[model samples]
Target: NSKINLAANELLFREGEAGQFAYLIERGRIAILRDSAGEYQLLSELGAGECLGEMALISHDPRMASAMALEDTTLTVITRDHLKERMARSDPLIRHLLQLTLKRYRQSLGQTFPDTSSTQDLDYLEDEQQAMQRMRTEHDLSHALDKQEFILHYQPIVRLADRITTGFEALLRWRRDDGQLVSPDLFIAVAEESQIIEKIGHWIIDEASQARTRLASAYNGKLSEDFYVSINLAARQFPDPELPGVVQEAIRRHGLLAQQLQMEVTESQILENREHAISVLHNLQSMGCRIALDDFGTGYSSLAYLNRLPVDALKIDKMFLDDMLSDQASRTIIAGMARLARDLQLSFIAEGAETEQQVEALSALGVEHVQGFFFGRPFALETKKEPA
Candidate 1:
């Protein structure tokens, strides 16, 4: 369906026009023409399997040459979005090298075409040194998985009524070879953009599932009946139709009850691909796993969609707790969320309650559960006693 039919002698694109797509000749020939003064002259001819119009996509410039179908051509069109997405996922070293090559090509164009040098060229040259640093980081990330350098830290989610630890959210940390610990914020986006999140996400699910039993045992079986390990699902992983199967396998392999594994997702993640997201969530529910809406009230939190979702809990964002003491608006919003959660029969958890007073205020606002440093910070399983 992405294939297009072009008539013989058809102009695909003209020089001086913005390039929106690159085309692959699937079944015919294409002519590449360059304009000199006011007359267009043949520059090159391309046959089937050849690609054209891609330079502008990489260089962020107008088409340098025009393309026309030499015959009844069938071409596969690659959109700018597709190219840009792939470029974003490529290593910084490769991207920089590509830009450098393109820059030289542009410079050589001065003999025939107009000189196209600009500030963008200067910026690319300036960042040449930064490429090595970025390349090293990228190489480190590529090997981090094979080296088993990732670790999980659990933060207690405490029940307000009895002040007991009922569940813990599993947080990921990258431990570099040099003994440096990297936070998720530092490298998660990179992993997601590079498509490494899929592999890492599966590993997290497996680790958390295995940890659930050990955690309960560590607490001498005093952990509540609702004891669960909450694993944050990356947005990039949801599009995989096999995600539910992955979770099911994790729970089954670890001999865990599906309810003991909670999957946490943010609002924006759900909205980005609503149909697929809903399908994946429903499949998870069918396996008896629970779903929690994390970072609630921060993004795309629509009541209409919220009520329709197969969610079991609401985790209020930490920002609300940060401002709850000084801002009446924050408290009012927390109160409304608590009441909404209760009315909907969903569990309510307020995050980032650092002080007793904040916990008191959250408790007064009808929050049923809380998670923050006030109870216990995120502690590694190997370094610390089991979550209190």
Candidate 2:
């Protein structure tokens, strides 16, 4: 009896998975699918005000088909406990019929009954389904990269001190032939797990370098004065000994100062293979490339030797700013990170800022670099430099 909001194309449940809950669509449409010859066959589409997976309420039967939101949808969720309680109070004949119906439905799907003494088996089934889906997505992403279906979108980063646009962060976007945009939230994690991140990381650097050259041309050779495009590197990529050389080559090929490009890695990524990461960062810095520790202050490692990490900047994670105005503790922590950055002589950037008040709060805390909606949304760019 609670509402859940789902983004477009979000999965609600899969075929053959135990139905732990059902939903009534309050808005948008849902696509029901099933496997047919190794591909998904859309069986039907449900629209607003329709109930889904209601049969599962009567018995502990598995789902018969997959359900996915066709658009942004809001659904009223009906928990299993409520359904079970209602069933218990029903007439004996009705309950018996429901059990028989569910048994036949499972047999129709060629499913075998499992020992259901606990819910562990059901949980495992759901997990396996999700894993399989991710595997398929990974395959698609590999092909996407080859076909050039992927592209980069740049979001502006500004300096609070001068209120000037310094540079942009090169973010990834996957646009399919159908003109639908696949969210990075869905694919980035899968790419990271499948070890395809290294190739993606390289492509991003190559693209960002080319873009920087263009951005500089737009500024009549002045973009490099203080402007720098930041590219994110996965922690897993650290183990690739060739990474340093690869980045240095990109900088050399563009004939741009390394300071015009920055590489950002999360705090946790820095610790994934600390020794290897340290070596790579040193090599990058030696080549004049600036290094930024992204999502700063979120890692579990102690900050005892932060100075030894070979980083030139720290990006205060957005989680700290979510409540900076209402929570004094959040503001204090942000101020401390700013002070620490100053003492270490490393630059600091505040991310996820969205308002003037938030900007003022960050300014008072000594954060001079900030990037967020407060600046502007990311806009698409041509690989070649455009007139600024």
Candidate 3:
């Protein structure tokens, strides 16, 4: 469900009202109320990351209490359809347990719920808890930005033929106050869902540009003169009308050529809004920045549209190479991708080459570049004396 905001002292719902939806508090506080002797009495107050009115949604009954905003509040609405959709995927055993639990829950309130099949409250409840955790993480991410707790680590992109460092990919990392690095997988999706990724993405561009300057100076000509730092563009970033301007500003601010900065977008991300993605990529390309179609062959990479898009490179996804040694189909696919990249006059970068044999196999296929742990793991900016 989408989010809604309420001002202080606003009534969210009244007692005996039909439960059209439940709500998960993303921020601020809400007060639960009950009418007694013609006066509303407070039962409880729920702050950020709390869920309410779920029992009514679970039982298909009227709200047992009233709810009012204790302060300005941000809430995520949970509808009956949403609950039902979640239930459809729940396990049979879990569903049975939920049926019994919901039945007992209703009975405790002196009411009977006749429909046992409607019991999916367990999954709904679990999702509500997960939503609260996600909300908490999202809030922390927003604060992390203000705290400058985010970091960028550079991973080398190597030339396959000579195994020389040609460029690097800027990888994002979150370093909390405890100095423990948090994995991007845990927070990136939350940030994306919350739209905080746009701000975080812009920050990445600026940080990467600055890092490029440092890396160029520190490498002592070991890096290719045409060396570029590739920054991944989140799916949300492509539709942003201001994205081109943001990249242009970063390039200019770093006193670097646009070619020194590369933008990486996934195949699925591009397909999400093809027209808009094309327009944005073309705009960036016109500014002389490179655009790479990342994770190629993993999605609907139609040749019909591939020729039309403004892409400079094709980074073959790791899965193709992970099975290439044993799977002839994988080898054939890689060979075909190599030829396709050649035909399109695009740089072909094979990703996730961890072993010597994998590298040799990719090099034999005429894959020009490779990126993975075999070349170098991502390292901090200060350790820039050599490829890491």
| Order of candidate numbers by lDDT, starting with the best | 1, 3, 2
Q: Candidate 1, TM-score vs. the true structure?
A: 0.76
Instruction: Return whichever of 1 and 2 wins on lDDT.
Output: 1
User: In model 1, which range of ten residues has the least summed lDDT?
Assistant: 111-120
Ranking by TM-score: 1, 3, 2
lDDT of each: 0.85, 0.80, 0.84
Query: Tens digits of per-residue lDDT for model 1 on 1-388?
Result: 2989999999999987877788988999999998888888999999999988887667657787889888999999888677767766666667788877876787688634343434535544545676777666677888898898999999999999998888999999999999899999988877876678888898899889988877776653236876999999989999866677789899888899999999999999898888888788888988898899999888956687787898999998899899899999989999999999999999999999999999999999889999999988888775443433
Candidate 2 residue spans exceeding 4 A from truth: 1-120, 217-224, 383-388
Could you give candidate 3's per-residue lDDT for residues 1-388 as a string of tens digits?
6999999999999987777899999999999998987999999999999999987655666777899998899999988788676666754345555656867776797765354333634555565556567767878899998897998888889997776788999999999889889988888877877789999999999889878878887664257877999999999988667778888898888788999999999989988888898888999999999999999888976777888999999998888889999888888889999999999899989998999898988888888999989888888777333332
Model 1 regions lying over 4 Å from their true place: 1-43, 46-98, 101-118, 121-135, 219-222, 383-388
Task: Write candidate 2's Cα lDDT for 1-388 as tens digits.
Answer: 7899999989999987987888999999999999776798999999998999987665565787899998999999988788656655654444554555666777787767673512633533444455567767878888887877778887778888878778788888888778788878878877887778888888888878877766655442113266888998887788876777778788888777888889998878878888878888898888888899998989887899797888999998778899999999999999999999999999889999999999999999889788898887666666443443
Q: Model 2 misses residue 267 by how many Å?
A: 1.5
Candidate 2 vs candidate 3, lDDT winner: 3
Q: CA shift at 24, candidate 2, in angstroms?
A: 53
